[model samples]
Target: MSKNLIYLLGSGRSGTTLLATILNSTMQIHTLGELHQVYSYIKEKLKCSCGERLEDCDFWKHVLSKMELTQEDLSTLSQAQNYEEQHRFIPFVFLGKNASSDYSKSQEILFKALASEKSTWFLDSSKYIGRFLLLKQLKFLNVKGVYVIRDVRGVIHSFSKKVQTTRGPLNTILYYLLTNIFGQICAWLFKDVVKIKYEDLIENPEETLHKVYALIDQRYDEIIASDFVMPHIIGGNRLKSNKSIAIKKDFAWKKNISRPKQILYYILALPIMILNNYKV
Candidate 1:
């Protein structure tokens, strides 16, 4: 019943991994990259950021063993009745309560093992709206949020570059709009929602992290920022593989995306953009 969870909520590719890396650099904080994407990691047979297959990675192997779970149990949660149920399955397993037939006793073991570890708080950069919604229902632990936002054009550009999908520009902008709207609603519904601009995080990390640390009641450490090593994060942007952190604003969308597309993104994301004080 401790304040165990600090979830970084946002759309994928919007710097969740970057934020997680910074938080994990601090004292008494440990971050697990993208818990919701565990099933995808297994199915795709993705390697951990440590360069070993996820199951073979020593860090995650320990986590899985302590959870009293196999890769199969973790994967099956994604196939649950719905995505929210999948999110709920995490806490259900953690509290040793079963909300699905797919669950096992690993949840309790994982919780106790993590508690015994030195980390006082855990970061879950799931970046999914449903995950945040479900996390709010857990009474045994404190659930706080960091809602990360980037310009819609930047997100679409990143997606277009990184993701293999062939989504159209309008569709991409609409999707970004909806995702931000969902994040805003979650922030509105939650108590300790800290809003972070992706640009500010990279351009002014120290000040941004200090604000975040204060909000979470943790002492800010200036040294942790410079020496951060990426943890054994699960599913997220591939940038996690970088050995060191660099804060660079990726504004290629300003030049790469056509002006009409930029205008379209602005039009679709206008209200939420204004709410976040984003310049259109």
Candidate 2:
């Protein structure tokens, strides 16, 4: 079997989408946004940076069709559009909408059927390690996956923008510590896995993507040709995101993390950072 299927596994804000978009540009791949609706529905409502409703995209058009639903009946397909507020994990728990507690098995069937229908590549960017752990054991076993990791400081820095960093900072730091540690473990467990850093992917697109393409062994010309959503943010055209961002690099939320709070932030991150290194 050719390396026809590719999944982007990592936590949110770790540059999973950017890598996915580059793969979509690969020409041989027809990358879809996150398809964890089988395991998580949050992706169904989350808008791509491109600004289109994902369910309406051709990639999702193919995904939903195989699930035995149509555009007219999207409401009944999953609760993404309908459910306004939810814990992030609720949608991912696979609550028997398809009549089985084992969503991993059902997802594998959907994925295989999707592969059988076309020569396109599939990309899921939900960015959750728990989700990846569930799907890793499927029997189909022909998938080629990429694991995108960002510096933990970058992850905490990315989350400090919209929320209070009081406890949020610690939580974000812990999440980054936990998620990437899991990625490292998955690397040892799975054979078809490739790991890349988000900072490298964005700051040096061409060189890094060349490295990424080499790992997955996919051609890169067309993906490079297609327009990316955040060219400015990725290239040196913009400022770099701090290893741990208290404010968005765009300075879009400059007040979110103050210099004093940033001091506390670094202090908080130290133990978690040490824990990740020592425990891993």
The C-alpha lDDT values of all candidates are 0.70, 0.51
Which pairs clash inside model 2? 25-223, 39-92, 153-243, 153-244, 154-243, 157-244, 157-245
The C-alpha stretches of model 2 lying farther than 4 A from their native spots are: 1-3, 38-57, 69-105, 113-119, 163-167, 222-226, 229-280
Candidate 1, residues 1-280, lDDT tens digits: the string is 4447788877666788888888788776788787666656655778888888876897876655555656575556546523444443444433544343332222234445454353377888877665565555555457778899888778878877744454566777777776777678767866688888888888888888887777678788665556678888886676678787766678888999888778878888888778887776
User: What TM-score would each prediction reach against the true structure?
Assistant: 0.82, 0.62
Q: Per-residue lDDT for 218-266 in model 2, tens only?
A: 6556454544433111111011222211112332223456667655555
Off by over 4 Å in 1: 1-3, 39-46, 70-110, 115-119, 162-166, 225-227
* Positional deviation of residue 172's Cα in model 1 after best superposition, in angstroms: 1.9
Count of backbone clashes, every candidate in sequence: 1, 7
